[model samples]
Structures are given as C-alpha cells and as structure tokens.
Target: MKKSLFAPIFASALVLGLSACGATAETAEGDTATAVEAAQPAVYADLGGEPTGPVYRMAKADTLAVSGFDVVSYFTGDGVPVEGSEEFTVRYQGYDYRFASEDNAKAFIEDPAKYAPAYGGYCAWAIGANDALAPGDPNVYKIVDGTLYLNFSEDVATRWNKDIPGFIEKADVNYPTHTPDEHYQD
Candidate 1:
C-alpha cells in the first residue's frame, strides 16, 4: 500500500515539472520573434534619395544620425567642408565656400540646396528604412531645404526607393538614440 501511494506522488511531480518546461519554451519563442521584427531593414516606396558612387573620399570619413539618417562629409584641417566645392578656398565642414566674388558664394549659400545633398546630406535609405546611418554617395544626392544628406550605398538606396515615407518613419524611430556621428575624424 505504501509503495502504491508513493508512485502516485512521484508521477504528479513529474507532470508539474514538464508543464513548467513547456511554459518557459513558449516565452522564449515570443521574445525571439520580437527581436527578429526589429532587425528587419526598412524598405522604401520612392527611390529618390539613394546613393550611387562614392560622394567624398578622404583619410577621415565618418557618419552621423539625424532624424533617422546617417550624414557623411569630409573635413579639412580646420573642420571645413572639403568634398563638394570647386573653389580652392571652399570648405565643406563649416559650410563655407569661396567663389571669385563673395556674392557668388553668398548666392550659393542662400540656396545651398542647389549644391547640398538631399535628406540633409545623410544616407536617406539607411535612415529611412531602419533608422540606420551609413556613409553617403554625393553623386546620389539632391538638395532639399538647402541642406545636404547622404546615403549608405547604392544597394540600400535602391531598396529605399520603393518606400521613401515608410523608411523615413522607421529611421525617425531610431535617430534620437543612435551612435556614431557622420564626420568623426579617423
């Protein structure tokens, strides 16, 4: 009789242990699904602001995060813009450019969009799709709001074109807390 009673108790304990294990497995699977969703890249609807070739090249190239995009630009000794100017004294970082006359630079300055990059000169697709910040191709940019923007790469930009607004929303979600400035030296 004692043996029969002990067997039932042991069997009950085993059942409880197996149930606990199943619950733990379910919770783990749920957590993994959430992580995978977060990792997906943003797909674009309008392919306007993607990059092509390398926009700027220098010993020091960096990335920045702003409203979900990574903006890239090269700096001179005094932290001046160096990549997109025709004049010898034009600087890229400080947003200064020199022309034969001050008026010419001023005119360009007043409406830098005619010269600056699109989406604030950052990588539009990277920021838009997944709030990512990547180096931009100057050749793949357009001037919007008189500022420059950059892009991650040609491949990303191509995908970005499929859903521009959607990517922008996703990038906005990641921009505020993202690391890595676009123009850090070295």
Candidate 2:
C-alpha cells in the first residue's frame, strides 16, 4: 500500500521526542511512513460502542474500565491502577481521541497494558506472523491476569480463534517485551 510521505517523520516525532523544545514535522518517505504506520496499534472502526464507564480515580483494586467497548474492566489483578484521571488527550494510532481524564491517560503512560487495546490491540494476522500491527476489532478482547488486551479486526480474531491456546502463547511472548508504542506516533 502506498504511504503518506509525511507519516514516518510524523510518527517518529510522536514516539521519539523530535527536539528538546518539542517542535515536530511531518515529511517522511512513503516507505518510511508505511513502516511507521505498520508498527502502530490497529485502528478502531468508528462504531461508538457503549461507554463502559468514565475514567475514575485509581483506587485499591479499581481498574480503569474499558471506556469505549465492553471488554474486561481491570488492567491487572495486582491492582496496579491503569488509565490517567486528568483530562488529557493524544492521538493513539491515527485516531484523534480523548481519555476521560489525565489519570486514566497517565495510567497508560505508567503501564500501557493497563490502557492499551486488547490482544495487544494489534492486527492478529500480523501478530500471528510476527510482522506488524493490524487494524483492530474493539469487540474482540481478552483479560489475562486482570489486564485487558485487544486484538486486530474480527477476521483476524477469527483466525486467532482457530488456535486459541497457541495464539495466546505467542501473544504472551510478544506482550511484555514487544510493546506496540515502541513503533508509532499519533
């Protein structure tokens, strides 16, 4: 697929602070842009799923409920709080969105798993092949050890379903060390 010329530089600026002053630009090669986009979490289809619940203050045993979709509620069993409470926003993947609060957003900053989409929230096919982040399906998710994870589109989820145990095995291997944010920008 042809990529936007400015996507890579833009993505790079997003993840790796472009300058000490924070000035950024978008002017990357098409291939570079494609590469950057390929490394990000899957894009969500705008379905406006039910609001699970608004972001709330982190409390003992309280996990940030999945805001947009009806997935698992907690981020971890240890009660490690996820999601920031302050009202701040960022462009995740390519979506212009806002978290309920900064605390909920900060939770993700501290530990992305607490807020990152499920199934690694990446493309299942790409994950299966260990290739790249595939666009995700918000509805397909899993809660492991209390942390929620999202997967790629349902089609990919269906493929993952074929070998549930195996897919999880690979995902487990990929999750901790292979964080998705290491790849993209806004």
lDDT of 1 by residue, 51-145 (tens): 32222222122111122212223211332333322332333333323343344345444444354454334477766665544556654543333
**What is the per-residue lDDT of model 2 for residues 38-135, given as tens digits with 9 covering 90 to 100?**
43433222223332212211121112223333222244345332333223444333332334444444554455435555443454445555744454
- Residue 158 error, candidate 2, Å: 1.8
Positional deviation of residue 54's Cα in model 1 after best superposition, in angstroms: 18
TM-scores of the models, in the given order?
A: 0.39, 0.39
**Least accurate 10 contiguous residues by lDDT in model 2:** 53-62
Off by over 4 Å in 1: 1-104, 111-115, 118-120, 142-149, 176-186
lDDT of each: 0.42, 0.43
Give lDDT: candidate 2, residue 82: 35
RMSD of each: 22.4, 14.2
